[model samples]
Target: MSSAVDTLEQSEAYMENPKLQKYFKNVWLKEKERWVSMYRVGKMRVPVGTNNGVERQNRMLKECHIKFQVDKSLSGLVKVLHKDFLPAGYKKYIDENALASDSYRSYLNYIPPYLHNRPPKIVKHCMKRLNNASSIPTDDVTRVGCTVFKVRSSESLLEYEVYFGSESEFPKCSCPDFKKWFLPCKHMFAVFNKYDDVSWNSLPKWYSDSVYITLDNYVIKTSDYNSLKQSDIALSR
Candidate 1:
């Protein structure tokens, strides 16, 4: 099957080096899975075909490398990455359009967020969350102060004001799941996940940033449209 490496090799038509063929051919042949990965996503205009795109991507990654190295933690990097992907264009989500492409889901993930134009406020909170929790675990979270929470169900949303004194230890989330089954509830995590930093305008606009709204996953790619055949891509070998 034609793959990304094949595409890269194909693009060598405009190149001067014959040695590149011998070298990349060896690399491509050795890496069977990595080779065919690009067809799995419809995001990038190209994967390995041209030099300009790759060089630009590398330069962007280097900037991220600098930020993370200074912060000294991977979490800051991840949070920063999250904010970077916030809506401002420059992203291609995997919807029906992305799926219509032949091999768009098997091996591809989204681009690293560093390349996007991040706003100051969002990125400011991101850097702080990263800097403060740089030495801690992802699940190794901390909480302080009080915040309001709204719990939603099928019928209604319940509002609760959780209070923690200035010197008191932050309480675990009072959501039914955390209270009854000892799980990490969204509200409990939200109260302190956003860094209550010194700056006000720079503060993040989310308490639910740490919370995720996810549906159950299936072994196969689920689609709402039937224009394309529905094959079990989970086992597409």
Candidate 2:
């Protein structure tokens, strides 16, 4: 299994295990006993790889519910959620994404330039996993292209697809964490740790930029930013 199609074929076989097939069929297969590819449904391209968004919404709702003094009818609850909860949540989400993007880029300006273009979280995770000398969680890596690999987990004995890209492309792992939460999994980071050439620059666009905010107007002048940064450092010293 070299291509993505081959990976799917392998996944089918893996899912065919009696116990595993039953669970996947009951939970994910849908319709008849036949399993359908989500891609074929045409809406699977959205960045949502997990239920974290729904989970977050549920948490927020529960918290808000606890603070309410009066009981609300179903319609009243819907009205409050629409008129209050969603707008505030939307604004907070936007501000945070923009702030995070600006801060990360600003951080890059002051930090050791050798770190390249990697996401801080991914770099931290990679170093942590490597320094701890965690057993290689994956084996049987088969490269399909310059940037794609199919690998198998030693624990679940399941296969996953991984893709690493150049500046124009973003890295992706077929694992649930990467797919659902849009975060790099240890498996993806392990690939980076194993290879010397793959660096932060190989990350997908979302890893470096705000997925929710545009950074075009937020570019900082290195000279001015660096001068202020150095002055701040001297003051701290």
Query: Which one wins on lDDT?
Result: 2
lDDT of 1 by residue, 1-237 (tens): 656446776685625577777765677566765535434331111223466886865566556443455554678666545556332112223232334233343321321133112222333333443344334333333333333333323223544333321223333344443443222334333443444642222222232121111111221145334444454432121
Estimate the Cα RMSD of every predicted model relative to the unseen true structure.
23.3, 11.3
In model 2, the Cα lDDT at residue 98 comes to 35
Off by over 4 Å in 1: 1-25, 28-55, 64-70, 85-237
Error of 1 at 192 (Å): 64
Best by TM-score: 2
lDDT by residue (tens digit), candidate 2, 133-159: 246543455666777777677578787
Error of 1 at 200 (Å): 55
- Per the 3 Å backbone cut-off, how many clashing residue pairs does candidate 1 have? 4
What are the Cα lDDT values of the candidates?
0.37, 0.52
